[model samples]
Target: MGTNQVEMCPVARLIFVVYLLVTTCSASPPNFVLLFADDLGFGDLGCYGHPTSITPNLDRLAADGLRFTDFYCTSPVCSPSRASLLTGRYQTRSGVYPGVFYPGSRGGLPLNETTIAEVLKPLGYATAAMGKWHLGLGQNGMYLPTRQGFDHFLGVPYSHDMGPCQNLTCFPPDIKCFGHCDQDVVTIPLMYDDIIKQQPVDFLDLERAYSDFATDFITMSAKKKQPFFLYYPSHHTHYPQFAGPGAAGWSRRGPFGDSLLEFDSTVGNLLSTLENTGVLNNTLILFTADNGPELMRMSRGGNAGLLKCGKGTTYEGGMREPAIAYWPGIITPGVTHELASTLDILPTFAKLAGAKLPMVQLDGVDMTDILVNQGPSKREAMMFYPTDPSVRYGMFALRLGKYKAHFYTRGAGHSETTPDHDCHIISILTPHDPPLLFDLESDPSENYPLSLQGRPDLQALLQKIQAVREKFEATMEFGESQIDKGIDPNLEPCCTPQCTPKPSCCQCD
Candidate 1:
């Protein structure tokens, strides 16, 4: 009998239908899960050479796929870095430069700019964003994740430390509160889409809540046989650190380490969900941080391994981050030191998902070859911009091949006694006439600057860097600075059952 003519039992028909669904999903476009950590250092994970930080899941992820030794975020601070990452362009191009967006800032990433989510959504991907979204919240929440192309959004509007927190005991005693720690300060809202679900979030439960939400999203997408893009920018290891119940005091590195452990566990949970849902092999997972460690936090902050300086500087420690790419059957397991940046994510994902590039000019190049076949990196040079608001549209450093030139050098102070000390305030902003050059391959810590007095080769290198810089700046069109916009109290979100006093009294279970 022909296959079509053969009569089958109900059980057999059900089994056949399930087989077809699985086969179709396997042949479909791959899913994407990007895990972005806040203020996590290059040396924070066990895979990245952290001696005390417990990160078994991340370690496993590295072992199973590609581990990048020299990956970077375009900017050294939160908002600018995130803006560049999503748009695949420089933060200055998107107008998210000068600094991060405050809670009441009306400005946001320009609506004209395209994001990775927007690129994938038209291709039938279900996109979700969990954890921090410091981009901005424009009038009536017009620039939130929902408007930014994410199908589901659940997280804080900005940094966790932006709001009031009466309790100091949750953090390690050694970690001083550099931000708001009083009850009188504006309360940070825990948002679900555009709605403020909870005010003054119980941070102790945040990690768990985020994990649960992400897992649910993954499972739901898998059941519907839909491709998904999960952008989980974790808030752990940021200031005012707090760990979930399971991870508190679980690591020897104190609260910072404990928070990382909780983040690692959450990673484990997501990976397990992918595997259980039978989509692990079909998913392209990437784990990276927004920027370098917050060294000002002292003992409470993360370690940058051998890299110099930390957040708020153009040094390697400030922009270089730990990055891992995992795709079970697609990406070969190995370590690569090829130059790459967060900017490459959007373009690379577009290439992989068969999505069209946005009309706007993009600073990022596709690194799909590197991810798939262990090919050489498409990027050759990278620019380092200042995070300080005082320095506007300035390229402080540039790295070409193995040589890095620092036209300007500044250090973000790391001192426990001086709480207010920052890069712009304490450190001298030194501009080099010839520009200080360093061989990053030999000196990742940037301790030694090469002398170019009598060396023709070094002189040529500097000239080449200058040429590159000139060409880069010649075509550069800086957008209006969104971060410079002053804050507005009226823009702050309030819960559904509005309270008498507004945000301060806005609370929900």
Candidate 2:
């Protein structure tokens, strides 16, 4: 038979070639699991250099793959940031820009906007979103995860803290106050698909449940030989930082650290599940945060490392996040300071899965070359937006190469040491009649501002900003992000066939 193999002739060789092609074409696509955390800072994990939080699994994952020192979220807040992350479009362009869409708000990410799930669905990936769904809960049934292309959904409709116990009047709430935590005070509905699984799930029970859901989903997909995409927007390291039972005070960092520990454990468990299922090698896992730390809570809030300020600001500490990508043998293990953002997740995944890209303008680019080949990313410059998109007072930064220009600065999103705000932001504008510039490479802190009087670099930066601004305004007609208007709160859709129950707490976090 061995001798006959060579003697079989040209037709046999052609048949073998065709067999190889068919086998390769029908091979399973890489399974994707996006572990996105809420309010996690730039220096919150052991892999990212936090002294107190020991995240061994994440650290090992980083060691086994790639870690990014300068990844960013599109918005400083949750809803808009999540929208940008899912669509790969700037939050402003997504029209979800006025701010987060509240529970009663009729606004949602327009169905026209393509999410990573929608892109992968046509390619046969079984997609599920297992945690926070802050984009929209429109009554028109237009904005829920079920409508957004996710095959399965579990977790809250929005932030765990948007409960009835909201600290609306007393933000940076008092320790004694239950604010967004006490189930009696406020309860974010924990849903399984569109039906309410639990109207008021104990906040402490979330991380463990999400991990269980994710692990089971992975196992089921593996058994079926189907590719899976798990978009888990974790509810840890966020406000009312409640650790699950037996997890409190597990770390020296206090309750926040305890919460982080729980999240870390889940990561370890998920990886083990992947390995046990024999899919670890072919899976593409990404870990990142929605935005930076919430600095109002002091020690309870996360540390943003050397980056200044924290959440709700356009500053580095607010938008810049710690990012890691892992695949057993595919991605080269290393670290890079390349500028990347959550906006790139959609495009990069689509590129890897052989899925079709949305026809709209996308702010994110494929970083597959950077992830696997250790090659430079095509991302050249990144545009930073104001903390409040409603008022364009110019508190923004535009990065070109190694230089960044500050078009505006204010006292609102100041350093951690800054006091609790009282409904008014004290403007501390950095001179921008002709914006201030900073060489982020030399001065990562933005301590010294460069004069833009007659420098070529300044002219180049301004020209770049102008070009970006033009494009930003091109789609400014505001498509479906009318989150504040047309809110009937009556048309909400669900999975229980014609379900139309209005969501309870759609308020902002």
- Strongest candidate by TM-score: 1
TM-score of the candidate numbered 2? 0.85
Candidate 1, residues 261-314, lDDT tens digits: the string is 889999999999999999998899998999988887876778788887778788
C-alpha root-mean-square deviation, each candidate: 8.4, 8.3
TM-score of each: 0.90, 0.85
lDDT of 2 at 316: 74
lDDT of 1 at 148: 91
Give the Å error, residue 14, model 2: 23
| Residue 180 C-alpha lDDT in model 2 | 49
lDDT of 2 at 102: 57
Which lDDT tens digits does candidate 2 get at residues 223-293? 99998899988888787676666566568887788778888888898999999999998788999998878
The global Cα lDDT (0 to 1) of model 1 is: 0.82
